[model samples]
Target: MTQAFDIIIVGAGMVGAALATGLGQQGIRVGLIDKAVPADFDAHASPDIRVSALSAGSERYLQSLGAWPALVAMRATPYRRLAVWDETPHPLSRLLPGSLTEVEFNAAQLGADHLGHIVENSVTQNALWQTAQAQPDVTLMTGQGLTSLEQSPDCARVTLEDGTELSAQLIVGADGAMSQVRTLAGIGVTRDQYQQQAMVISVRYLGPPEDITWQGFFPSGPRAFLPLHGAGDQHPDETWGSLVWYDSPARLAELKALSDAQLMAEIGKSFPDRLPHLTHIDAKASFPIARQHAKHYFLNRVVLAGDAAHTINPLAGQGVNLGFQDAQCLQGLLKEARRSGDDLANPRWLGQYEQQRRPANRRMMLAMDLFYHLFSNQIPPVHLARNLGLGAARALPFARNRVARYAMGLDEQLPGPVQQILHRLPGLNRI
Candidate 1:
C-alpha cells in the first residue's frame, strides 16, 4: 500500500507526539506511529514503568499543542522549590582549615516560581494521543514498526512491518535510545555508558505533601524526593511526588528483593547523615538507566529527536526537557524553511539543525558526567574540591543566576513570551 503525509514521525512518545500535534496545528499532515499503546492503568508502575519531568518550556509548548490540559488532571504535580546538595564525605583537611563543606541550591533563586511539573509518562502520552486523534490531518498508527526505508532526491519511501508503504518529505525519529529510523537513515551515535544505573521507584509518602523538591548526591548517585499529593500542612492524605532513587544495578537488585518494611529500613542507611523522610516511604518499582546520543540529529530527510538524539543522566531530570528543546527547534526550523520557500528535506537545512543541537546536547552530557564523577569521588582532594565548588556556587549570586537561568531554559536568547515571563519572575531575587 502506498500513502503519503507531510511528515512521518517514527516514534509517538512525548517529544514525537508533541511535534505531531504542533505541526498538525500549522495545517501539516502527519503520520505518528508507535510500537505500543499506553497502558490502561498508571503508566509508571514497577518493572516496566514510565515517567518524565516536564520543564516550563516543554509544558508551554505542550499547552500550545493542546496536550497539557489532559495530563494536569492526572498525576501532574507542581513544585515551587528545589534543594540540592552533594553528599561526598568532607576530608579532615577542610574541617581543620575552617572551610565550608556543603553546597546547596534553592530553586527560588532561579527565574521561575516553580521549576516545572512532574507527570506520569502515560498521563502525558495519553493526553497527546487523545488530542491528536481528533485532527483530520494527523493519522495515528499504533504498533506499526518500520520495515525498510529508501531515499531519493526528493523524499524518503518508508515501509511498515505490516506491509504498508508511504512517502513523506520528512521522516522524524522520535524513537527511544535504540532508534531504528536513525539506523535506517545511516545515522551514527556518539555514546558512553555510565558506570551506575538509576533504579527509579514510585513511593507512597508517609508524611506531608511537600511543595519543595529535594536531592542529595551520594558516593553512589543521587537520592531525589519529588512531592506528590499527600498529607501536608494544608491537606491530609495529600499524596505528592515520586522518589527517584539512584543506585548500582547489583545493589538495586538486592534492595528490590527485600520486604516493604525491610527495604525501607535498608533505604534509611543512605541518608542517616541527612534527610530520611523519603527513604522511609514504600517503593513502587525500579529500572536501569543509560546515556545515549546520536552523532547528529538530522541526516537528509530523516531527523532524530528526543531520546533518539540524546539521553543524559537523570540525576537532575533534564532528559525530557532537552527533548522538548529539540522538538521546538525542529518545528521552528521547518516552519521557517517553508516560509522561505526552501525544501524541508534539503541537506543544507538538515545540517544547520545538527549544528545547532549537537553542541548543546554535548554540553549537557559532559555536565552530568562531571557532576556524577566529582561529587561521588571519595578521594580527599576531589572531595575538598567539591566542597569548595559548592561553597563558591552558594556565595556567587551572578554565577548562580546564570546557572539557574540555563536550567530554567531562559538564556540570553530565549524564544517566546512564555520563556520571558519565566526568566523575569521576581522570585529569582533569591539568588
Candidate 2:
C-alpha cells in the first residue's frame, strides 16, 4: 500500500513527535513513523533512566503545542538554581590569592520562577505522541521501520520494512545520531568520540526534593545531580533523582561491574559532599560520549532535525534542548512556506533553515568542545586559568545573566525581526 502526505517524519522521538504535532496543529498533513510506539505513561510508575533538562524556551514551545500541560500533570521537576564548581586544588590558586572556582545561577536572579525542568524522556515523548495522534491532519505509523529512502526533485519517498511506501513533499530525518534517513539521503556526518563514557543512574533520595541541580568537576570529568519528581502524589520530601558520572571507558566499565551496594559506596565517595543521600537505585546504564554534526542539514527534498543533524557532549545537558530548538526553527520555516504557496521541498526553503541553524549549532558545539577540553585535563596552566575564569564569571552579574539566558534557550526565542537583526551582526548568532 502507499500513503501520501504533505510531510513525512521518520522517527517519532521527542523532536520528531514535536515537529509532527506542531505542523499538524497548523493544519498541515504529517505522517509520523517509528519502529515502536512508546508504552503508555503512568505517573505512579518508576521514571525512565533517560531524562532531559528542558529549558524555559523548550517549555514555551511545548506549552504552545499543548504537550507541556500533559507533561506537568504526569510529573516534572522544576529546578530554580544551577551550581557548578571545580574540586581540583589548582596550585595557581595559592599564587592568585583567591578561591574563585565556583559559580551559581538562580532563577530569582533572572526574574524567572524556575530555570528549567527535569523530566523523563519517555514522559515527554508520550505526551508529544498523544498530542500528535489527536491532531486531525497527523497520521501515525507505529511499529514500522524504514526500509529505504529515495528523493526526487518534487518529492521524497520512503519504503517501510513491511513493503509499504509513503511519499511526501519533504522528508524529515529525526531518527537520532544514527539517522537512517540521513544515511539513505547520502548525508555524511563529522564525528568525534570523546574518550570518556557516561554512567547514568536513577535513584530515590530520602530527603526533600531539591530546587537546585549541580555539577562538580574533577580532573577525570564532571559528576552531575539532576532532581526528579517523586512518583504519585508524594510530596517533595519523597523525591527521586539522576546521577551522571563521566570517566574513561575502562573506569566506567570497572564501576559498572560493582554490585549495587558497592556502587552506592563508590558514588558516595566520588560525588560532591552536598549530594542527597540515595536510599534506593531504580536503574543504571552507561554510554560513550561523542560529538557529531551532519555535513549538511538538508539535501534535495530531504531535511534533518534534532540528533539527525547534530549531537553534542551532554556536559551541559543541551543535547535535547538543541533538538527541540531545531524543531521550532524548521516548523516556523515550513509554516511560512506553506502560507506563501511555495513548494515545501524547495531547496531555498531548506537552505534558509540550514543557514540559520547550522552556524548557531556549530557555535554551541565549539563551546562544548572548549569546555570538555578545559575541564577534563590535568594540566596545571589550564587548571589555573579555569579557576580564575570561574571566579571572574561569578563577579560579573551582567555577563552571568546573559549566559544564563542563553543557556535557558531564551536567546533563540527572541522576536524574529530582532533575531534577524542580531544574526546579521558578526558573532551574535552564538549568543
Which is the leading candidate under TM-score?
2
Q: Output the TM-score of candidate 1.
A: 0.83
User: What lDDT score belongs to each candidate, Candidate 1 first?
Assistant: 0.68, 0.81
77-145: candidate 1 lDDT, tens digit per residue: 787766555566655434432222333444577656777776767777788887777678899999768
RMSD of 2: 4.8
Instruction: Compute the lDDT of residue 365 as modeled in candidate 1.
Output: 59
Angstrom error of the Cα, residue 345, model 1: value is 0.9
lDDT of 1 at 339: 75
Q: Which window of 10 residues has the lowest lDDT sum in candidate 1?
A: 422-431
- Per-residue alpha-carbon lDDT of model 2 for 178-260, expressed as tens digits? 99999999999888787788999999887777999988879889899999876436545568899999999899989989989
Could you tell me every candidate's TM-score relative to the true structure? 0.83, 0.89
